[model samples]
Target: MAKYSEKASKKVEQAIHTEKEGKLRTGTGKKVTSRKQAIAIGLSEARKEGAKVPQKKD
Candidate 1:
């Protein structure tokens, strides 16, 4: 199992919340409707902020 930092978890939570509220968007401006995508976005953000997240799979 992969371990995520507190910050990464918080980011994922926030992303999920925003997605449920219909306020999350993708880079192309499309509304995010999938839970998996929301988590991906959160992890991406966490990675950008230097959170302890695992490397993205190809």
Candidate 2:
């Protein structure tokens, strides 16, 4: 896995936890049901916060 900043890792962890608890949601107000989606959501949020995350692979 690529390296992620502490903040980014924390955000992802929080997102995963929320997902496992069935509390995560999407922009369309739909429930999050997949772990991969949750991780993507976390990375997206990390990008928003300017965390030290790598660029998306092509």
Best by the TM-score measure: 1
Residue ranges of candidate 2 with Cα displaced over 4 Å: none
lDDT of 1 at 20: 98
- Residue pairs clashing in model 1 are none
Q: For each candidate, what is the lDDT?
A: 0.99, 0.95
Off by over 4 Å in 1: none
What lDDT is reached at residue 28 by model 2? 96
**Model 2 accuracy (lDDT, Cα):** 0.95
Clash count of each predicted structure: 0, 0
Worst 10 residues of 2 by lDDT: 1-10
Candidate 1 — worst ten consecutive residues by lDDT sum? 49-58
lDDT digits (tens) for residues 1-58 of candidate 1:
9999999999999999999999999999999989999999999999999999999989
